[model samples]
Target: MNGAGSAKRPATGEAAASGRAVAATRTGPGGRPGSGKSSEAAEGHGSGPGKSRRFQAVTRDTARPEGGGRAAPGDAPAPARQWPLLAVLGATGLGLLLVAFDAFRVGTLLIGLAMIGGAALRWALPSVGMLAVRSRFTDMFTYGGLGVSIVLLALMAQPKAWLKIPFLDDILHFTVR
Candidate 1:
């Protein structure tokens, strides 16, 4: 076998199942049982064969989201490219600071709005840098869902709730203790 073939071929003398011998093609590359001789079998990811088996995603690197490109042009400074992410982070940080300083309601409101705003920006912009996680629709859904949830929870926080629905309280009545 050539060098490439040697690399591609799994080492022999390795096969088993709880100390019992198994077939070669069934044992997988590491001689580990149920390790997936084919990538789709082992990893349960639909990336198919070939490249999927070679990727050690847990230990190595994570593939960026489909739209994880620069917010600005390539020639622009790094900060400019990541302005979307920075804006979201800065707002969230400010919200956290306000909360730490004992301004709970306003702080939480700002935090939730910032997330909602981030979602809006992600939707409006083509290149949002780190703000782009997963595909565009997925990112939008995740950010919008979380932001709405946070905002709703903030508005419904104890004492004198602002946006109360009678049925909502009844649905969540298990927390009376």
Candidate 2:
């Protein structure tokens, strides 16, 4: 066949195998799998003139600027202190232990107080490390609201009475049945 016809035919024999090897070595940026010119440029070769242009563009885009790609030494934020959150967590854990031992009234009070203290700490401190699971306003509202609710519930629990919600007993009776 003529040269044009031969070129149109599929690559076979040694040529096909070598082509596959070349394709396999053409890895992209970060050595990830993709089409780019860096692999050819790295081996001091190019598929065509376009390959060199692609390599130049890739290098230009990835080049770091004047400060070496990091903030200056004094520009970093200080590390957060965690003791106040840990103390609140410890108190809540102790309160749970008290509840397990049947000291329900005192345990509930302790838990509620701990929650209130956590809310106070969240309000007073700028950051609470891992304990700042939510925004400051959200943390304060949730902690304070739950603490007040728990304290009220503890005060009005079985065998005590300072206040009661109407129809709650009826709802409980209906649900239990």
The models' CA-based lDDT, in order, is 0.71, 0.62
| TM-score on alpha carbons, each prediction | 0.64, 0.49
Q: Against the true structure, what is every candidate's RMSD?
A: 9.1, 13.3
* Model 1 ranges off by over 4 Å: 1-64, 173-177
lDDT of 2 by residue, 1-177 (tens): 224422432222333354423333444442233323225434555555323333231223443222222221334543224466677889999999999999998899889999999888777766455556566778889999998888888888888655687788889899999
Q: Summing lDDT over every window of 10 consecutive residues in candidate 2, give the lowest-scoring window.
A: 64-73
Pairs that collide in candidate 2 are none
The number of clashing residue pairs in each candidate reads 0, 0
Over 61-153, each residue of candidate 1 has an lDDT whose tens digit, in order, gives 577776688989999999998999999989989999999999887789889998998899889998899999788888888888888988898
